[model samples]
Target: MAKCFPEPYDAVSESKAELLLYKALAEQLGPDYVILHSVAWISRPGGSGPREGETDILIAHPVRGLLALEVKGGRVSLDYRTRTWVSIDANGVAHDIKNPFDQARRGKFALLEKLKESPAWKKLGIGRFNIGYAVFVPNVGDGDRLRGPDAPAEMIGDRRDLSDLGAWVGQVLDYWSGQEGAGQQIGTRGVDALVALFARSVSTRPLLSARIADEEDVRFSLTIRQAAILDILRRQRRVVIAGGAGTGKTLIAREKAVRLASEGMRTLLLCYNRGLADHLREQCTTIGGLDVATFHQVCHRWIERVKAKNGRDLLSEARANLPRGDEFDHHMPMALANAVDTLGPIYDAIVVDEAQDFGDEFWLPVEMLLTRPDEAMLYVFLDENQDIYRRSAEIPVQGEPMVLDRNCRNTDAIHAAAYSHYRGAVVEPPQISGVEVNRLLASGIEKQAALIGTLVTKLVVEEGVAPHEIAILLCDPADRPARERALQTLPLPATVKLGRVEDFSRGGLTVDTVARFKGLERAVVILWAFDRCDVGKDRETLYVGMSRAKSLLYVVGSREACDHILAAQT
Candidate 1:
């Protein structure tokens, strides 16, 4: 009658001992407790790559708080000299395994750290209950050789503890869970909250999947200027649309690709950002004859095709033979354009997003890829105010540039904060009503990271915003690791996943650099500005980060920078 979370069986192992123990506990403890299996946590290494580890079993009781158990089956041997635990199989071969006690302890620390971030843990007042750990060896009974000074009596369990069901529960509650069986307990309200918290923490559904499912409820309408650009795109073969953030540039590009594909035109969608390109691909995959690629990806694919045709990778040869600087993007296209006659256009139409990020040299090869450079359909979307990379390429176009001035994404209050960076830029007029942007001032980078974690938790747990709707964007590339480490320490809810923008879901939060999220929007954005405090030097970059939020925005930075930003906004 006990509630089980994510099922009790393990696909990785064939052991039935853990389930047997579960059944015994259910019969003893009744339906008041919830059992969670295979709960996992990501371990962030200091110098090495992150590793993920899972706990075998977690039992949550209203009276006992929480218990983590490491369950093992079959014959187990302890090499007291090497201090190693091994499982001896039927063939008499020893399989090296982690110590069950150590495994259970690690799970305890991970869960404690995770719980530290959740407000629910504090709200339930279950903090008073002891978080316990134990090791269950159901196959091994209390024998002559097994019980010794090395074997801790309370932590280890054998057949004797398993035989008398009612007595075993009493022993577990007393020795393992640290409860004397009465008085030291949780109320019904506290029990309910703890059960819900434990269930969510161990849920198997990926945060991104839930967010994608929730995106159906989000509503957005194209502005008059946006509709006009689409109308013009229907008639013109080649056109350029320029607009600032929230002006619907990405949306326009996506719609054009889908429409062209619907007409059976082979369309190629291009963007400078790989993450945005990935998102575009997902959005356009349903349409036949529509392909999405980043500028570098397209170049790599073309090089691969050339290698297949002529048995030589021209791009690699060009990189080695050609006299070029560190600007690979600028030099790559120029180097390849010299051999453009060898390659021909592959698509009926090409739609480029984030055009401002491309240099002048990068476009020649891109233009050469068009089957009919002049007659074939081409649509380029750009916003000069968002040219954070400082590329000054005049986007190749056939006619007067179409401009979208209405901001359909951000509210009037959010626009006020973003527009403070550029005094006279012809940006979009804010159309939505939004929460007032806040300037979170911290003394240092470490403090800033801590502050951001707290703010994100508050927004998700207390403010009722979905984890996926929130984004923490770093302004400088150098600050990625520090920001990631800081985010790891926060006790974030289980529903929010930290990931890159291209593959993110609406059900979880995303932590990425500002550049990767150029074309994306979030309901709440916390812009980390600790790297470069000078707003004058990086105005466009600051503006790009500020304009990403649709509803709420918190600009987190050093004290001096935050004060300066607040003053300017006023």
Candidate 2:
């Protein structure tokens, strides 16, 4: 049967008859036609830029190219002279409406224009495709109401002729197959390829796969190393767990805090990054007796609490004396610890994520905040390879760290690319399969921008990737604005929101510097390394950026830059 992207049951409808007709057509056509329901225009009709044009049913046939059908459920009558349509309701009341045939024609051209602008058609070597438009009045007894100069013989049909939509579709396909043009006459291979293209376009299979990937990411599976860490936590009050990127360091820390909180322990979950801390807070809030905050947040709160208790405004004093720069974040906790000593230990258990981001000076205050400095439960998760802040103070670990080696995020292809730049001795293997890492060589910034635009367009339009699922990560923070400009150069589908990570929180493609996207992951990543001077010798930064992708990774840069990265492969 015809494969419907969304089955008729799930689709929203103005009337039940419309849904019934869609289901009937799907049952009639057997696996040859790919039918899409509620296809909207890439751009608005008669607008300078793209706008929404709604189409009821879209059919993609191997030989016929594309067809848009405007289905009218009730008895629809056409006034030839007035060029208007009157749809009769169940109450025998006629309501004047805009001509659906005209609407379908506009939708047809709108979709055709959209396809023409996309790079997918050119890549597939179908520069042009024959587009057909029809108005199907399935409930009308006589086809005469819908027929006139406004409705062509082939473009207008009723239930009598359109009921067996498969046969009608076959006739249209055969007619288009015999036409003379660059778009006509598909070879046997071409037919299959075209049909597959349409299937991918309308299918929700990718979303299902994405959901599975999301499940794999959010739900933790205990690896041998993770199990060992849990075992260590059970016995040891002071523990340090260290591993490379994608080694599930963050997952372990979150789970440890969750378990402690679930046991009714007054647990404190801390991280260096505010974004990561926010994520932890959300995850840990479900359990009781947990307080989640970043290192700076903890310090600030400690200062505030001390001031409130002693009636002394220490925050104002520290703010006036604190020096500003990149060192601000690294030094704030230490400054707070020096100024405040009266605050006693408030938490029974403490868990730190991204512990390497803090210095040794910061941990003394963390220790003081515990109920028992020597016996209180303390778990610190560390990955030195991801120590982008370059803290020099060595964290005091009493014994050997429990190392996690298996990666749960990146695919084999992604691991291969990231491993080429990895500095640590420990290597992580891929957990999932079928992901590919693609590399492109560009001569300059402009060339790289063009390449990014083309590749992303093809991926969204042809391969059917959700815009928000794709991220454009830049090595240098300065390149982010320029990269966003390049994204605007692309004529992507209107559904894509081209906003930065700071402003946009909803779906659409995200363009951000790799540093800002450190704690985030996407289905697909496009890493732009146009100006490598920013991270010329920093392998950790490069490695972190490369490993952010969960499935597909696209690395674009100059040949020299590309070669330099490839040379690091061991």
Name the best candidate (by lDDT).
1
Candidate 2 Cα misplacement greater than 4 A, ranges: 1-220, 306-311, 319-331, 338-340, 431-435, 499-504, 533-536
Local error of candidate 2 at 111, Å? 68
Q: RMSDs, each prediction?
A: 24.1, 24.0
lDDT, residue 286, candidate 2: 68
TM-score of each: 0.60, 0.58
Overall local distance difference test of candidate 1: 0.70
Which lDDT values do the candidates have, in the order given?
A: 0.70, 0.68
For residues 1-570, could you state the per-residue lDDT of candidate 2 as single tens digits? 877856776666776666877888888987766777765422212323224355788877666677788888778877677776788988899989888878888887776655443333434566555667777777876765566665655666677865687777666545444453427533334444433323222111221133222332344356655655664465467778887777777777877786666544578998877656765675566677799998888877877777677876665555556645233554566546754577656677889888877876688778777766666678888877777778765665598877788877788878887777666666668668755677788886778888887887788789877777788888767656666676688766776776655443445677877766665577788888635643446777788888888789888888777666655553
Q: What does the lDDT read for residue 331 in candidate 1?
A: 45
Clashing pairs in 1: 117-491, 211-506, 211-507, 467-508, 468-508
Error of 1 at 342 (Å): 2.4
